[model samples]
Target: MKLTSKGRYAVMALVDLARFDNINPVSLRDISLRQGISLDYLEQIFSKLKKNEIVKSIRGTQGGYVLNKNPNDIKLTNIFNAVDEKVKTVQCRKESKKGCNGKATKCITHNLWDELETHINTFFENKSLKDLLNNNKETRV
Candidate 1:
């Protein structure tokens, strides 16, 4: 399964925010510049994130955004779900008799892809923003 820019950018933007938001709220423009993401696109992503309560906006002259929960509390799956990103591998539903290959039964590799998708999703579920932050720090050293 291919991850769209919305899913990738949302993670990048949040990582940037997590790095600096402790000092103050982070502006979408700042994250846009730092992450090389479009300001308008970030706005759209943030709107969904806000709606999902993944983040909260501060309104004022110094207004911006802050995470609704701690970094450790925010899993990659949570970010993905908040942005309506699906980690789907197969094109067809497993429950449905219709197959992705247009045949009566699923292709030989269908179970393989489905199992991989489950593992990938589980990895994301186990990983938190705090884990990413720590990994970043380790890589820098």
Candidate 2:
């Protein structure tokens, strides 16, 4: 399964948020400049983030966005869901009863794909923004 730019960008943006959380209410413009993401794209992404309660917005010239929860409490899966990014390894929608073959019967490889999806979700669920920060620290050192 390949992670699309949406998922990657959401994670990157959140990582940026976590990095500057001490400063609180980080502006999208600042994140755009630092991360090289487009301001328009960030607005769309932040809209979803805010709706999911992953982020909170502040008003005023000094206002921007801030994490609603601790970085350690925010998992990759949460970010992914916030952006409507599904961890799909197969063409078929797992939520549907029909299979990839356009039949009601399950595909022979359905179980395989389903298991892989579970593993992927589990990996992301176990990882938090804090993990990303710690890993970055190790790499920099």
List, residue by residue over 1-141, the lDDT tens digit for candidate 2.
Answer: 478888899999999988886876899999999999999999999999999999999988989999999999999999999998987677878677777789878788988988998998999999999999899888974
* Deviation from truth (RMSD, Å), model 2: 1.8
| Candidate 1 segments whose C-alpha is farther than 4 A from its true place | 95-104
Which is the leading candidate under TM-score? 2
41-116 per-residue lDDT for model 1 (tens digits): 9999999989988899998888899989999999999999989899877778867778777898778898899899
Go through the candidates in order and give each one's C-alpha lDDT.
0.90, 0.90
Q: What is the lDDT of residue 71 in candidate 2?
A: 90
Error of 2 at 5 (Å): 0.9
Candidate 1 has an lDDT of 0.90
